[model samples]
Target: MSNMVKIAMTSDLSPGTGTTIEMEDQSIALFNVEGNFYAIADTCTHRGGSLGEGRLNGDIVTCPKHGAHFNVKTGEVTFPPARFGVKTFPVTIEGDDVLITLD
Candidate 1:
């Protein structure tokens, strides 16, 4: 089972940008890609780096700590230094709110 949590508003994040959201003692990384929203684990699998502070290029986010790349839309490792993929959450937009499904 999963619960949809409202992480942010559409206006909170612009296209090609990302932010970190804290809820239920978990850190979630939210990204806005061309008006589409995606959610993933904020911590990089390789290191304890903040994925929210990473550079967003298209749908991929590059970790600032060691240059590891992760696909925000799928939470898959795209580049080196990170061998494992992070957890991905389904995103839903309702009116002005951005919600993500969390298990």
Candidate 2:
């Protein structure tokens, strides 16, 4: 079975914001869309830019380095210069805490 780790609480993330976290040698980006939480790889597929520091427009996140856009909900590349998609993790909310399943 895959192990689930508690990354942060709901209060830790505000709406339309994201945070970068290091877990088990992996860099993960935690996003708060509206009130729901989503997790994705922090590194951009096109370049080694930080996705968490990028701009959040609705569900789409734009890379600040090369302007590569990605959908946080699906982790799909939506813009050019980024042909590959980043890895996305399953996120669950337990009460006021946010948890992620990493495999």
Candidate No. with top TM-score? 1
Cα displacement (Å) at residue 57, model 1: 0.5
Q: Candidates' lDDT values, in order?
A: 0.93, 0.92
Clashing pairs in 2: none
Compare the candidates by lDDT and give the number of the best one.
1
Compared with the true structure, what per-residue lDDT tens digits does model 2 show for residues 30-58?
99999989999999988789998999988
TM-score of 2: 0.97
- Which stretches of model 2 miss by more than 4 angstroms? none
* Candidate 1: tens digits of C-alpha lDDT, residues 34-70: 9999999999999889999999999999999999999
Looking at candidate 2, the ten consecutive residues that score lowest on lDDT are: 45-54
